[model samples]
Target chain A: MTRNTRLLMSMIFWAFIIYLFLPLIMMVMMGFKDSEFIGFPIRSWTFKWYQVAINDMEVLGIFAYSMTIAISTTILSLIIGTWAAMALGPTKFRGKFILFALACLPAVIPGIISAISLRIYAQSLDITPGMWAIILGHTVHNVPFVTLVGIARLNSQPESHIDAALDLGADNVIAFMRITLPFLVPSLIGAGIFCMLTSFDDFVRSFFLGGYEPTLPVYIFSQLRTGMSPEINAISAIILLITAALGLSAERLMRRNKKKV
Target chain B: MQTNDSTVRLQNISKKFGSVVAVEDFDIFIEPGQFVTLLGPSGCGKSTTLRILGGFIEPTEGEVFLGDDKVTKIPPNRRNVNMVFQDYALFPHMTVSENIAFGLEMKGQNKAQIKKRIDELLEFMQLDGFGDRKPDELSGGQRQRVALARALAPDPKVLLLDEPLGALDAKLRKQVQIELKTIQQQTGKTFVFVTHDQEEALTMSDRILVMNEGRLEQDGSPKDLYYHPETTFVAGFIGETNMLSCSVKKIDDDYVVLDWQGNELRGVCRSGTAKEGQDVSAAIRPESISCSAKKPGNKGVMKAKIIHRVFKGSFTSLSLEVDGVKDCILNATLAGALAEQLGDEEVWISLDPDYLSVLLR
Candidate 1:
């Protein structure tokens, strides 16, 4: 490559990175600004917004609600997704490709479309659109992610281990518990974190399906309509920190599991 | 421990997958405390037969018996048989000790007894002091030993090994073969080992069942299969041999005269029903033929030119081209000293009547 091409490539790469992170960096910076209004030129440093954001009872309650939904979604998705993965992971049967495609439909379709369809379905069924409805929607959306992870892990695992377990006087359930489940731990941890993050950060789905009680993302969207404040920036920074921590821990767990294998 | 009553019998078993017949009319009765090997080439149904005996797969027809009990419909976990898979299949998540103790734990053995049994097996398999390590931390041979130890912990009635040393290097494989034989003898348990390697089978098994094309070709002691093969397949598969297509010219009381490429060769009539003017195949082991530079006063000696001589350490293999035999190449393994002196020279090859194996085509 010539000097011009190398320079152009590096410039484009940095430009892409800056484009992705510029808003996040600005939000974090404004969280420390003393001014009530979020503006560019000059801001005195203050931690008052952080203090106010942490102390707001309504924001804390909404955060708790999001956590509850995310936790429930993670558990439900993990259970159903693991069963689906085990059924589809290792064997060939008729219509397997179609079944797999249908399983992954929620992930492939746009989130807003699924959210609107789910709301309509819930209304037709005469179900109240509230926390339970949102939880159901999130579970359906995240099952594919968990299922894909489980399938990948199962594909790498040898079937001989289960056979050996069975040949050693362990029945099917014992073999599964002793060999298959332990082998799937790393993928389970990674997929659980992924499901939790997906639920916590989801906006459009919650906006459509959530009833009187608002989730953290919906609450933040409402707050933005009122006005862009430093308090919102403070909360976003905290969420980013939590997400980074979770991502790092997931990476560490996977690396450690790989070394063990 | 119950070696005396652990006779396994596969009664006319046949298994088919889809339309492909994996095993057909496979029948074998393993005596108590015998070390039997299922030996064949790849895709020859040896592994399938072993799996069927282990209750991993149900045979499409026929019954399986352990001693007097029929176990045709039994699941693998319910049968008193264990297998060492070709890949070892050691549990990666568990430590070596944990893996070996798994079966005993499932049997509801007390903790102390399980611990004691594991220690004994670890020592017996020569894997002492490595119990705390995971399988990934061990070498290939070590992992195999661990797999064997795990299978032996519960003391199953019969242990099946499916090419367990297939993953090891050549040197390690030879060492494991000896160790495995010694272990089988010491345990006095019925062991049914499967391998595609003919030499491994000959070295380790008390009796070998050779299969080809989903059918049992021959089953006997290794020496019986090698020297007195019942079919042409067994004669060629067990060892290096020269096969001469011939027709019986005359059958004497104890000897048969074979007409081969316009040359008359006399061989001992081992086949009881040899008839005159019948086509047959004459098999001669390479080691049995003696090569000499000077013509010997032997009745069955033939003059041949040395086409190629491969200098193996213990013996030199000479490929001979005879004047009368134009269609077949005769191979003979001579002593290294004699082979060195007879380079590219015309020599007389003598086939003793006792070493010749005659098979009906």
Candidate 2:
């Protein structure tokens, strides 16, 4: 290709990226306005909205609840996913295809269907639809995604590693903990962050299963029903900032680990 | 009780992955302090047999006895065997000292003892100052030494090595092979190695088990396997040999007359199993055939023309095709002086029947 074609392609790529971020830019601009309602133009800039969201006890409680659900979902999914992947990835057995299909069921199924099924099951078990329900539903949707990342990481690992460890007198558990686990650390972190973000931004499951409790996404949706307020914009801005920081940190950590290895 | 020459024995061992037989009814006896190599081409059950001996896989059929103890069902963690994998398999996360000390730590050795053993092994492997370096930080040869130290730290009954130096460059591999042999001699541990390289097997092994298609073709000392291969497969696998089809003309008690390409060649039958009017293939090493520009009044000289010449340092290989005989390649080491005038010239080649191996057709 000519230089002009390359330059035009790069410009188009940047344009696509900017288009993706246009809504977030608008949200942040709307967040800083001192007006009672969010609009296109920011007439004034103030810290009052930030203070409002930071000081609201009810909103703080919801944030705490959402954080608890997100963190628990991430940890539980990582454990289940890593274990399931390790058990099924390297070993050969009968019905391996069936096991793989079952493991992928969660990722292929629609999230809302899983949410409805979870709500039905939880109701039958006399477990009320609340924070716990959201945790269970998010786990159902995120575990398979985490398992896929774990499987890819495990499959790329050399089989000689486990054999070497065993030859060095390490049992199965010791080999997994010492050799396999450390090698999977970067992918583990990557998968955990992905699960956490998936749970954090999920709305349909939280909307269907949550009862008398609001996750962050549900809370944002409820705020949209009422007129858009600067306090809500401020919360959105804080969430956006947190996600960007987390993404940058994850990338930086992966790079550092790669270099260290 | 033979205390010094105790052997590691495998009895009717068989392993199958589903229906594919990786190792089938294999048996081997490795004497103590002997360097025995399981030499075969890839997928010929050499590494699989090594892994089975190392206790990484339970045999599907029979038992393993190490100095009278049955160990077929023993796990790799409990077996007194350590393996150096093809890629070295050094722990990328651990320092050289930590990697070497791992086996000792697993055996519940005290930290002080572990440190001392690690230090001694480091010194022995000439990696004394590289204790703190990770496997990736060190060079390929250094990582291999660390792997050796780790496997040797526990002083296991058998040290299993799976093509350990296969990943190195040719020059480095030769140097490390010498160092490994020295280490094996100093330690006097039973070394069970696996490789497909013919030269490596010839140089390193006290005894070599030649395998093919999951079956043991032949097993003997290096000289035994090299000088007298049991079958055509063993003959071709062990070294470079020209296997020529011949019909036995007359077989006396100690002598056999062979008709090859309408030429009657009188040669001694070492094992003397040839019957009269039987077909057999004779394995003749290239170096066994001595070539000269003029007939030297030798017993079995054949008139042949040189087709091609390959100049190897310190030696030369001449490809010869006779008038009524098939092409025969001859290798001679005394090159610049003896065979210089015979290049591209009609030559008479002499063969010693003592170096000939006859196998059934």
Q: Candidate 2, residues B166-225: lDDT per residue as tens digits?
A: 999999999988888888999998999999998999888888998988889888888877
State residue A101's C-alpha deviation in candidate 1, in Å.
Answer: 1.7
* Candidate 2 per-residue C-alpha lDDT over A180-257 given as tens digits, one digit per residue, 9 for 90 to 100: 999888878977887888888899999999998899889889889976688898898998899878877777765676
Alpha-carbon runs more than 4 Å astray in model 2: A1-15, A251-261, B1-6, B16-21, B252-255, B266-272, B323-334, B341-344
Each prediction's Cα RMSD?
A: 2.1, 2.7
DockQ for the candidates, in order? 0.87, 0.77
**Candidate 1 structure quality by residue, lDDT tens digits, A65-140:** 9999999999999999999999889989999999999999999899989999999998888878888889889999
Weakest 10 consecutive residues of candidate 2 chain A by summed lDDT: A252-261
Q: Which ten residues in a row have the lowest lDDT in candidate 1 chain A?
A: A252-261
Candidate No. with top DockQ:
1
**Residue-wise C-alpha lDDT for candidate 1, range B91-210, written one tens digit per residue:** 989999999999998899999999999999989988989999999899999999999999999999999999998999999999999999999999999999999999999999999999
Candidate 1, CAPRI quality class derived from DockQ: high
| Per-model B-chain TM-score | 0.95, 0.93
Q: What TM-score does structure 2 among the candidates reach?
A: 0.92
